[model samples]
Target: MKWQLAGSLGLLLALALVNVQVDVKGYTRSLATRVLGALTSPTSHFTDLETSETSDDEDAEISDTSETENSDTSETESLETSESEDLETSETESSEMSETEVSESGVYNYEGTEPLDLTQKLMDSANKKEEVRNTAGSEYCLSEDDDPYTGFATMTPYRIASTPLKADDVIPAGCKPVQIWHLIRHGSHGAHRNDYIKFEDELPHLRRRIFRARVHWKGQLCEKDLELIKLWKVSKMMSKTGNLSKEGVEEIAGLASRFKSVFPGLLEKKFSIKRHPGDGNKIAFGTGSQNHQSAVAYISRMYDAYARYVPVGSQPSKTLQFYDYCRNYIEGVLNMDKKLKPYHTFMSGGIMNSVLQSVSERLGFPVTVANVRVMYNACRYYYAWYRNKVSPWCTVFTPKQLKVLEYWEDLRVYHDQGHRFEINSKQACVLGKDLMDQFRNRVENGNTELYAASYFVNPEALVTFITLLGLFNDEEPLNEFYVPKTRMWKTSQFAGFGSNLAIMLSSCVDDSFWVSALLNEKPVQLPGCDSSLGCPWNSFIQYYDYLSDCNFDELCGSFSSQLAQSRHWYASYMNEQWM
Candidate 1:
């Protein structure tokens, strides 16, 4: 073993003395040096061998260090030479990114340095449409040109406010408008099912009679008059049955835009156009389809976008047709067609019959009372549909005949919807209480987020509610108007298409909340109110306290039973005196 070990040691020493070339992916020195050092020092002490091996490893590491340093030096010089090019490329990329950002941000820096006249562009577009000039010559035919109540209950489109409210007019002295409660009636719609049916039944016969009359009075009936009679068609009118006309949609949209413009501070930011999930702003619409459509159009115009806030549709029992659920109203007013018997009898009697005959003679036709009613309806509808243009049918009746017809129409509305019975006004109590509750809640939490509250309803509901509000100013006047004596409660003022009643809650200088009422966009004073700014909040609350406790479900149930039990309910109601 000693001889073999000596021989191996000699071989290793020979290898170590001579330089051995080993290719180890260019790392050739470390392994060869370690082996050579270990073998060449075999006879030396183990500590000496370890020291020699460590020395060899250190020398190999030094050589590697020198190569790495040279490579690093070359890399540093190359990076320094390309630095300016790299910086230029970065700057170009950054400039391109900035331009992209500016384009995305929609900020246009004009070369001319002149601001764009957006308002003038809008005016030019409007002028191109020629809406005002076109509307100028479109005047509705009326018995009297001076008559302000031309539209009556079938509301014609008209301007609500000529000018917008100034800042002082809305905000008032030290008072800030916290909450706005608006009850808007749906826009102008076509006749109901019953009225449409009546028109269909009577129009064909009336048209035939007019044709015969045209032949009877050859020269007296002008070509225009004959053409008007020929143009009268039931199908065109029936197409819009119980739905809002295009003009009606326009009317509602215009009204909403006007309201937004008038109260920008209340409606701008931090306000919701419709009811949202969180408790902030609430806008409600009645369950009626017409009301919903009106709400959509109004919101679209108000926001200048598709309506974002989903509207809360009030229950029909609670808001839309509340009168139908009211026990007293359904039993006493709606079922009581007999109470209006006197007015109906008088209207169908010799006085009105003579007026009808006179109208027929003027038209050179033998016209019945039914035909005359149809003609009057045509006058009203055509006037409204034409967007305030007078219908040719209006020329058929003289001014005196129109007055008689107006009075007869008033009687019908008075008995059915007006103050003929106590229940008519009381039916509005439920809605009144709702308004009061909203106002009270906002007033109690004046610092809270509840800013605007809106309600949409039908025209009939609005009329009844306004009547309950004592809009006529005197009960005696209401009675006199019911007697077919005067036109105190004009339908144009109370229940027109897109009609609105706004109750503004303003904080006063004395730290009290004041309530103001605006009817059809015209400021009006309540009974106790001295000015148009309206009465105290307490008084407003007191005026509607009776309705606060009304149980809608109970009232509806009671009325349903009463209507079921009485076979002669209509007859019984007619006998009862007007309250």
Candidate 2:
């Protein structure tokens, strides 16, 4: 019986020691407090570091004495002192915490500090961040890395120099044709890119919490933002559709003006203003996947600027899908014949919308009907409702195309005012005919351009060749016909696919072909053609049609007086008869 009591006492002493160890280690001791009763089940202990089991009142009374004795154990006393020392060391290691920092209630116990449960605080922060990311996830923007695409206006200088061929130029080489001209396409629209956006308080308000999560709160370069930026860059650079940008507008317009400068009255002579020539050869042009169509679209938009008025929501004429089909067919025909492939590929409203939506989505906006329609109409209004959406306006000069066309119209109607070089009524009629002919050529040749060539050839062939051709690559002569003021720098330098093709043709046929020379920058004569012959060669290469269109009796009458009557005298006689 004494041994049993002694064993019980030793067990109590062990329990007391365990309680001390647990306390020193900062572990829970509720189990030790209840040891006078039944022990916690192994399963329960496994389930939790600490667990509770009901103890009888009798057992509880026994435990009270055990607890008192435990408090008095030498080991327990030593553990208490050691624990205090450990706590002091821990506090020293974490001494940066300000007094009253992170309060239990979470409210600042002091002006700028409060205590908090670190784990709970971390979890709360994470949740807030997740919420923010989800909220602003829908906006689209371009990143700094994305390349910018300008308008069609950017392409006009090259178009004027390279003079794309027209569809009528497809006739067999053996055929005796007077002249042929054409326009060609370069290529398709560029893809979209990742972009960045600046947001205002109002926009954020509209987006509400979503915007905050996705954009504002997250800041730039966050993982989510980076993902969006990457998506945009890939989509834009690889986009299969859409017109050129504002720069393209200027490109086409500049080309038109340069065309006028190069082939003065080309349109008038083509239309048969001189009694509508009966045997006039056709002019041709071609389009490609997105280029020519975009050109048309660009032109239409440019013309809209001159409209007296435009309907509020009506979209400006942009490229259509059918235009793209037609352009592709034109390119195919040109390619098959090996005559001169014209570029094809124009945009339609659908294509443009698709492009816009794609870009918007990549940027995170996912273009909606409301936003898309609004943007289309707005662009149309801005472009003047020219409505020719087939051509990609993103290249350049589309605006100038509008201006020059308007100028041509004014010149056609009022020829007596010396609007463009003095000419008699007959000369006026002849010029008008030329304009009509050019227009008809475009219409007859499936709405393409003459002198413009389309092909599956490399776009940079001409430009690259010329750039490497000569010793210095350039030479200069003062006021010389084929000389550029800056000296020769490079050759075969054309801007786009159409421009490159034009350069290729001109290079083959013209003797003074300097790659660096601007095709439209100076007046150059074709090889074997003399200035004394009253024929002038200019920057843009001309096909038979272009020359034929300019061969007017009134305009040429003074060249060889013995062979023709004075155009002025003839005009006077005709006018007198009418009077």
**lDDT accuracy of residue 451 in candidate 1:** 70
Off by over 4 Å in 1: 1-149, 154-171, 218-223, 270-279, 312-317, 337-342, 473-487, 542-544, 547-579
lDDT of 1: 0.59
TM-score of 1: 0.65
Estimate TM-scores for all models.
Answer: 0.65, 0.28
Model 2: per-residue Cα lDDT over 1-579, one tens digit each: 999999999999999977755553342122222231122122332222111111222223223456446633753455445334433443455435333332333322333444433334333444565566445443322222143222222222242334443322321222212222322333223321111011111111212212222231332223433333222111122223334554444544555444334433232234334433222322122223335444454333323343122121233212111111222221322123312211101112343344445534333444443333222222222232122322211211123223222222222222211121222222223322443455345434534335322121122222322222211222221121121324322222233423422221222123222111223233223333342111222322242233234334334233344322332332342223211
Question: Per-candidate RMSD vs. true structure?
Answer: 37.3, 25.6
Candidate 1 lDDT over residue span 379-410, tens digit each: 76766667645465666665567666666655
Error of 1 at 351 (Å): 4.0
Q: What overall lDDT goes with each candidate model?
A: 0.59, 0.30
